[model samples]
Target: MILDRQLLLSNAQALTTGTVFSTNTIDLASARDIGIGDNLELFIRVIAPLTGGTSVQFAYVTSANADLSSPSIIVQTPPVPAASLVAGSEWLRVQVPALSDTTSRQRYIGVQYTINGTFTVGTVTAGLTLDREGLAVYPSGLNTAGF
Candidate 1:
C-alpha cells in the first residue's frame, strides 16, 4: 500500500529562477496496522529550469496532525553541480523506519525548497499512502492504488 505523495515544485524553475514550493498530505486511518520494520518512500519531481539560485534545497518535516505536539523529522536534499537540470526533473525516495510503535490515524508530511537564500511557498499537494505488510515500501515502485 502507498503511504504518502507530494509535488514540491510544479512549475520547477532553474537554479537561477528563484524558488517555489508545494505539498500534499495522506491519512493513516486505514494504516493503523502499520508498525515497525516498515518504511516510507517518497517520489519528488523538481519541474525544470530552476533559475536565479545558487542551488535548490529540499526540506521535509513529519508530523501527526499539523500540530507542534506531533513528532517531527527533517530531511534535506542538496543541489547538484550540474546546474543545468539535465533530466528536466529529479526524484526523491525516502524511508522512515518505525521510530515509534504508535498506530496513527493521520501522518502529515511537509515539504519546502529554498532558492539560494529564500524559502519557497509552502506544502501543497503533499500526501501519504498506506503500507500494511511493509511489502510495498521496498525498492520496487510506489503502490499507486494507495492514498
Candidate 2:
C-alpha cells in the first residue's frame, strides 16, 4: 500500500486558451517495488474559470506510447466527472485499490476537464500528486517475483 505522504498539486494551469486547461503527463512509474495488493492514492487540485457547459474527464494509459511531452494519452470511454472547483481548498482525493493478482497490468494516469458549452479563455490547471511507496506487484505467481 502507499506509505508516503499525500500527494500535492497546486498552481496547475493550462498553456493554451480554451474552456479546459490541462497539463502535461506526470509519471506514476516510480522505482519502488510495486506488487499486487498495493494501494494507490492521488491528490489533485484545479484552478480555472468554467464558463462552457462541458464536462471534465480524467484518464490514464500504461502502454509504451504514452506521450508525456505533448497533449496526448487522454482516455475517451466512460468519461469521468468534473467536480465544481473551489478556491483555496480545491484539493480532491481519489483512492484506488491495487488490482488483483489475477488481473493486474501496467497502466498510465491522466486527467482532462471539459465544459458542456463553448467558452474562450476558460483555461484551468490541475495539480496532481501520486504516492506508490512500499508498493509491490502481485500475481505472476513466482514468475514476476524476482525471488
Which candidate number would show the highest TM-score if scored against the true structure? Answer: 1
lDDT of 1 by residue, 1-147 (tens): 443213222233333334434433433444554333445444454444433345566655555764413434466677643354334344344664333544422365555545564323222122233332223355857677857
User: Where is model 1 more than 4 Å wrong at Cα?
Assistant: 1-21, 29-40, 64-71, 79-87, 101-106, 117-147
Model 1 local distance difference test score: 0.43
Estimate, for each residue in 1-147, the C-alpha lDDT of model 2 and write its tens digit.
222222222244542323232344334465544333434454444455433344444433223323432333323334323345333223334554343342233343344443444433334433333453244577664565555
Q: TM-scores, in order shown?
A: 0.45, 0.43
Worst 10 residues of 1 by lDDT: 119-128
Best by lDDT: 1
What is residue 26's positional error in candidate 1, in angstroms? 2.7
